[model samples]
Target: MSSTDTIVHILPPLTNQAQVDETYKSKNVTINTQEVTDRPVLRRDNTGLRNFLADSQDNQNVGYDGEVDTLRRLGRFYNWILTFSVVTRYAFYILPVATLLAIPLSIFATIHKESNIKGIKMMGLFVWLEIVWSSLWIAKLCSKTLPRAFRLCCGVISAGTRKHSLMIKALEVPLSIVFWVIACWASIPVIAAFNPETDVTVLGSNVHWIRSLQKGFLASVPVACVFLVEKVVIEFITVNYHRTQFSARIQESKRRMHLFELLYEASTILFAPYCPKFADDDYIINTSLLSTVGKEIQNVTDLQTGTPIRIFDNLGRLGTGVTSVFGNIVSEVTGGQRVDSKSPHAVVSWALERRPASEALARRVFNSLVSEGNDALYQKDIERVLGPDNHHEAEEIFHALDKDANGDVSLEEMTMIVIELGEGRRAMTKSLHDVDRAIKALDRILMCVVLVGAGLIYGTFFSDNFFKNMSLYTTSLMSFSFAFAGTVQEFTGSCIFLFVKHPYDVGDRVEINNVDLVVEHISLLYTVFRRVDSQRKVQIPNIVNNGNWIENISRSQAMSEHFALAISAATTFEEIENLTEELKEFVLADENRRDYKSDIDVEVANVGDMSKLELKINLGYKSNWSNEKLRVARRSKFMCALLATLRKVQINAPGGGDVAIGDASRPAYSVSVSDEEAKISRMKYLDEKESNKYVKDKGI
Candidate 1:
């Protein structure tokens, strides 16, 4: 038998029983195959493999077409809106200026007409010309479409080939020339049309010149207005059309890609037995395949069926398992309570029930976009997938995907998403290499700019400012100018520096002069850090002149803290050893400390002559150790547990051992001491006191 025939033979046949049962249970309408047609049909239009594939293809084509159409429609709508908006805006601005100019111009025109006075007519003509010029200027200022119109014109003229700056410059030159020509042309006609002989002028000038100029100027108004309006409208329409076309193209691309993705997913699922396993047993199937299925279903269901499904495609098997566990816990916790019924979870579920498939597709698409070069997927593509109504939802998904809050997704982010989606480590090393290169290039460019600016200030402005300040009057002006320029330059430089050189960002724990803090604010001139222990804000200037070390403690792989314990002198070394062992076990058993390397060491720090033993317990914590409160609480609990164990074992000496809590709140036990022990204790006390004094002195 042929492979196709063998596959067909192995395939399961659909039966009406399941559908009938579901309909009966839900009390919904059921379509009976037998009642619908007389022939025994092999394929159903709404279900089965063949129908699914055909429907997918058809839907993809429709989606592409729809996207294009929508883009075109929106572009046209915006163009018209922009045109009318600009015209209205310009009209409002010009009306006031025109009114002011009209008073003076009318008075001059009337005087020039009656007396035939040359001076009066000239004055009136100039006033009228001024009014027209002022009106034009006001219109130019008022037109909201000017900037966008200019940009669109530049873009078109440059054929998208020139740099933005060059295109703007190129367009500005022609626009300025056109404006001047139109203004001159309008004035010339007004000057020529004035006829003082037939007109009356009360003042002593020839009314003919004034009337002639006014008439010419008035005639030019219509021409100028038409030109401006036409330009604005044309630019708006062109831009809108271009945008619409671009959107349509993007939509079409996405639709085709989505169809391909669905096909790939289905094929993967169908031929699971033929695919080879790569690395581990866990790596048998690519998680992207499963996610793709969920994503496709989500997209189709959202677009066609309007259902919402909370898909787990973005999560790895382990992540999915954990998520499922947590979800179950959350459900159980809020299941019966009144609060549960009104919770966001309940709302989400209800929303999901209303549109399961759409929600599922959104989840899947979000995960894919975030995990797979989300930057490559533009806002337009998402709009196409989710439809216009759910564009806001797509935006939320995008924000969630950008976990680092960097405004852009990096390979690390993508890997994290893939890991969550259950895709084992793929070849993502190249992406990291690219990111490193980009960072290095940015740093180099910033360093160059800073050096150049510093050089310029030192050579041209610094020395000159001092010399000019010798004269008080000149000094004041020079100082003001210098200060203003410096301020502007500094502000601009700082903004540029932030984009290029990010020393520290929010949520990063840093250390300055041994004082640990979390970065609270990062500005150009200064960096502010909130002390971890006290939450006090510390400000540090970014001394660009001198390179300073800024330690990022959060980036470290591990952080360690020492716990000192002193036991009674009567307590034997053997007892101390046993106690230390117990402490070690407790610290090691802590889930929080599991990630740390197993290199714990416990030793007698000092032995007191009287009956005291000083022991130091060093513990290391993973960098990812979260829950600061819980960590401290756990340390306290460990100490308490050790104390109880010690008491149970009768390890306490005849004289009670004094316990002192140190770093991480780990307890320290101390015993009574003689002269030598006293010297050690005094020295230790002095060292701590000096440290505190130094901190205070430094204003840290």
Candidate 2:
């Protein structure tokens, strides 16, 4: 073939040849058209050639233009939203401040007997003055855009190392509300104090504390309003923006975890050429270079399928993914490139080849240079976009990888060490198991110590004092023995109930006397549960067995039945069947109900006597599903799906099912416990049934 023909075949056609020519001309890079025809044009600069290839590849992709446009539009939209948020936030802040100042100004005007500035005029002037001051104060406090400030503050607070994020969020709301209220009320006293000639009676007869309190209240109001505004703006941004950011951060973390795994696997795969062996006594241990490859494979599995990693052995720590452990690995391998570390293939290969440590060292050197005066080649952008915690973790990993205790790590050292480590690889499962066993042993020892301490205190003081006053050593000994026995029994019984009864563990669905919850924590003394609907944690005493009926929904034999539906009363039995059929199909189709022994039952529960017919659906499912929220959610979804199906069918045949949808409401459902069940529950109580039955039955 001719050289020109070969060049034509290899070089892809460019749409913007004119633009390319112009760029080359501006850079003083020669591009001979006649010479290009004979051979493929190659840039003298490698970086330039790479950029050209990348740009050309991106241009060929159909989605590239659309993605760019979409990103631009989204950026503009976010900016506009941020601007509006800032304006509205400041406006709300100024309103409260203006109102506070107006009260004092009116009092001053009245005292001066100046009719021009007495009522509305004085109020308007003060309002305007406060508005300007408040705006300026807010602007000074949050110099940047409100959203940015909020993100910074919330991000700082949300770091796990700080106090609980939820508690901080909780405190923000009430603190804002309380301080604003106090500040507003304080204005009344400030006005009275400032204007001595002002009639306190004109304000209110109840305004007794004039000078001292009035000024304090007035001064506090504006200051409080500023703080309140800050809190509100921060919370709004946190809920709407920061939440999504945090979720993105979590996803990014998972992605990095997968990359680390891939790198480990790739490293292992490359190490296959070495075929290193270790000896264990008489047996020659042929450890596969692919032994640690499972972690990488699992990470890839999780990323590809979006399944949570099962790190914990059982459901005790359900949803606690392997990402937590693997996250450290990702941080180490990626070093300064965590954002890009999602590329598992690259990470794995790097790890296998022992090039990651060299890359990490280069990154650090580059960063250090940029920190100095090397601004031309290295910039601030070169520094890793690491979360505060991730940055700290990366530093630790770098130090560990340095090996020789030198400030810097070299590729040769890294490769040699990694190869040695890989050769002697052992499964981490045994170590993890040992750790868990140790923790359990510690807990048991702690519990025994607490019980012994309690017993000692009771015997030493209470027993001696009571018996001494009665003048009987024998009685004291007997009392002490009885007390110790009682304490031991109570403690042991609590532990047994927690372990044996297993009403609810850390992640079980339970109902304490009809109050539904998902167990968050299970301890010897108490169980902490999050109410399924409200997501509020409730502490249930282990001593609840003393009277309260503790129902383990996780272990129930039968599923609780409850459902609501509305249909036109004028509808015939045949028409109702169409609706009921849809409902039945929905319930039966649910994955939760797949293991159900019996089919679902849908009945015309009530004829409202009006125009509507109330229908009840009784769906069956395995009771040990252990998530009441999931149960409710599944039922709701089924109902919605059924309703949609019915609507589709009815669309084809007009008036076939003349059903008027009732006011979208959720009615209360009640479950009745039989007398036998109640009696059985009472018999299990610790205290006398007769004495505390009423309180116990009340579910207190």
Candidate 3:
């Protein structure tokens, strides 16, 4: 068919072909129309759908070009603001130290009555001003968010775009100008007081103008430090302000992105064709549209019912009972939900998840409180377990977890409390463990400071009397006393060393040298253990513990047991090999077997006569199943199953055709440590003993 005829066939014939020709020409399509048609024709609605798609595409493109300028400007402004803010932070750290040093110097000058020096009165006045200023600034910080307080007190926005950023910088100029003016004017008074023309005198002494100016400059040092501090503080506040605003903006952008994606998905779902013409054809619809819709449905339900409902309005209450100002601010900023760290479920969780000694203690406390198979526990029951020092904290935990405020806490409530405690205990244990080092250093330094300060004050006030009264004998006695204190401190130092360096922590099953024990508790001076043999608590000094070989039994995730079986020498090698394979399969089939660990091994343990052939096998299982009683039970069960398998396979012991466990005639026996292993163990023990010489010698 001709191209003209094909076009006519595809599109319906029109009563006015000329109008169709004109429509094609308007759309820039070439068409050959010979003449007008008089036949009445039907028109299909194809153009309607095409026009809709075109308009939708145009709408999506709107405002796209303008967003480029906005993004570029925002990036440049953010980088500039953050860079300046960082430089200001370094100034904050230095200014406070300068102010501190200035205070004593100013006081010393006044006390010595230097020329043109003011009385202690002026020193006190300036110090008082600084104190009041610091206190007020701190009060403002505590009362409001950093950004809000910064804007109010510093007269700056602290964060925003070019115009807004300029406005903030402009607002800060007036205050800065005023501060500089006052600082400069403060020096004029002292300078004029000592000028000959002014004839100024203070405390009945004529002062040189140069001397007055020097004192004036010294006084202004503190004021200038305070000014620098304020400036740094403003920048610090600005940095924080911008960071928080950026975070909020990021969250907003994420939500907008999600919304845009959802819209695109919906459009695709509505516009997509029902079927594809080719296998590799692209679909107009989003592939994940159905999943997105389901997620949206779920999100709507969660928003309507979940914790987020309480977030916006009740967020402030999260910091309700927190004592630290920093703690409160952190809580407020982070939504404050986790402040109740000592609550029952949280504490219990901390114990279990971190597997600390606290877990055992917490469990015992719970069991005692819920005695007689009772469902609930009283607060008093917990207090008894916690003892005096921890009673109040334990009670607070109990009350927080009780939820309904009932005097009794239920088992379910206790479980939840334990779960919540997991995070808290881990954090607290690490903090408490590390705090020893900090406190030790701080105490020694502070003691030295106090002693030196006391000695200086005494010498300054009564040096003549001290020299007159103190003799050679007195000096000798002082030296002996210091030696005695040093000896005592050495012992204390040993305790601190053990606290930080001891290998075994509480709750670990340890073998000290060759003696087995469970660590009951750990203290600075001693480690208390529960003897495995007698179940008696034993307290050993830190020095003694440090002198022993320490081993952690429960630390390994998997445990292995070795068995050497005696097979009848009369049995053929084929029967022995078949039996080994069968046992291997049997052990591997056990539910408790560790998949990641190497499978059970079966091999000849020793070369022997045909009458006493031996097979050695190694079986490893999950460590939790290897506790003493359970381990024995598991071994017995496996042995019985193995003997039964041997009988099924017709493998015989020396005496008869039946398989018998623990019979010398049977095919297997338990294996002990080999000679090589024993030697290595002995050497390790010796090495440990040698390494522990410091602790042992100190104890001696």
Candidate 4:
């Protein structure tokens, strides 16, 4: 018997309630003399094979088109928010200027209606055009302004959907062209009205206003042509540069996955014998079973369907983890808990080791951009960093790094870009610093230009009007000079004071303006410091730091840290004193501590009211161990201990009198206590210091 005649037929699983009649709507021949579709047929032992096939199909369905609907919606929503923010920012500048110009131009049009009809008409039209320009700007602002980061995210999320991209292109390209045309055309009437020689006449007869308007628009034709040519030139170079990089990345990915592809092929061959076939009596089954296997393997190999999604999902998880970790860190720091980023043993390990793991991480980010056996990164290296979906941004970054445009991004080229970027930042900062100088220079130039132009105009045409406003103009000049001098004098002393006396360097712990801060970075003009609690960077001018009572916390290695806790006035002094000693013991026994200043002082720092008194504790630690985070943590621990001690003596409360801070039944004694304990309890153990101290004292 033939293989087709000896075939076994198994019906697919009945996932739905379809009738046998509906299932067998199409004609089907017998398989091994059995009418498979006429009745309920079951595969006795092919469940594993069926499951594998089903899973393969499901995996295959994980394409950008199918999975990115949620991402696309999210992206659109984010884009709208960003667009609104950007437009709101622009409108603040544009609306005022537009209004300023419109009012003056409207006044000009009304006053000079008959005498200078042509010039007045031109001004009126330009005013209307300015309004139109403002409207168009509003429109452009409402439209999405997708930055590189957004583009990268969108690209990653839905690489297949070109819908948003296409829509943006369709809107922007024509809108830009139209706006440019309008601007160029509007400039023409102004130019013509200003020119003395060009009379608006056609065939020796005075031209109509409509004819003049037509001429202005017609004059924009050459400008449009020039604009198109320039755009085309830029597009040509940019498009080619991107295309080459994209192709290189594609080739590199395929090359990298060549071995996997081979393994896939071999698997297909190995599984061919076991692969089930659909037997047909009417035609020969010449097609290989490998086609089905290839489809299954393709699901695994396709980066678009597999890796990008996983990477983004992993990134999301990583973000969540980082946020949770950061929250914990903030919680610990804000509370003045004893624990820190480094415990005593950790600090010792870090200090003695000479290099931390974070250094390696920084190095990897910086150095691993380069590919193997190459001095510079190729397109693939960038793809590995930014991902394959972000060819546009990668190409842009690649071009920026590949300064000579030979397409290879060398390490030196990257370093040079960084240097240039740093220089640019410095230039911007210096420009801000020299704002007074710039204003002075600009003021002088503007004054001279205005005075000279006014003098010329007054002598020639508007002499009567100029003389009428001469006193007003002189008063304005005097006001301007006074303002400029006053501003310069105000800022000069501060600038000199900051530069001359460099009090604090970067990374110093200090209390400036009554805020405890870790100095992150100090620029020439401003000092950047991170607050102890939120980790938010606060930028204060050097002058402000100098003016404020700056207490350098890092001055001495071992300085006393003072913190206060509030308690009910009714609470016994014995309880307060006992709590203080427990806290002191807690502070003294810190294994992570390096300072070892065991001197602890407790006092009533403040008597707020008859209801409460501030319980103050003071301790000293090494300068190295004087991280605000560590201090905050230690404080949190003391607060926790205070709560525990308060729980021992309760006035009246519900829920077993646990002395919870926010609970309805929580004690008034514990009510004002800051740094509520986290839901997750943290238990501090003795560090190397405490262990060694115990060992030495016990003679073990």
Highest-scoring model, lDDT: 3
- At residue 260, candidate 1 shows an lDDT of 28
Query: After superposing candidate 3, which stretches have Cα over 4 Å from the reference?
Result: 1-502, 532-534, 564-575, 590-598, 607-615, 624-636, 639-700
As for model 2, its CA RMSD to the true structure in angstroms is 31.1
Candidate 1 lDDT, 590-679, residue by residue in tens: 342333334566777887775677777776654332235545765676567767868865576546744445735666668877999899
Query: TM-scores of all models?
Result: 0.31, 0.27, 0.34, 0.26
- What are the per-model numbers of colliding residue pairs? 57, 8, 23, 14
Tens-digit per-residue lDDT, 155-228, candidate 4? 88777545445444534544455555565454544424533554543222144664545454554444444444
For model 2, residues 66-162, the per-residue Cα lDDT tens digits are: 1111235676565555556666656655667777777776774677444332322344345445644554544444433334445567777675423
Model 4 RMSD in angstroms = 26.9
Q: Candidate 1 clash total?
A: 57
Candidate 1 positional error at 478, Å: 8.4
Candidate 1 deviation (Cα RMSD): 22.1
RMSD of each: 22.1, 31.1, 28.8, 26.9
lDDT of 1: 0.45
Order of quality (lDDT) = 3, 4, 1, 2
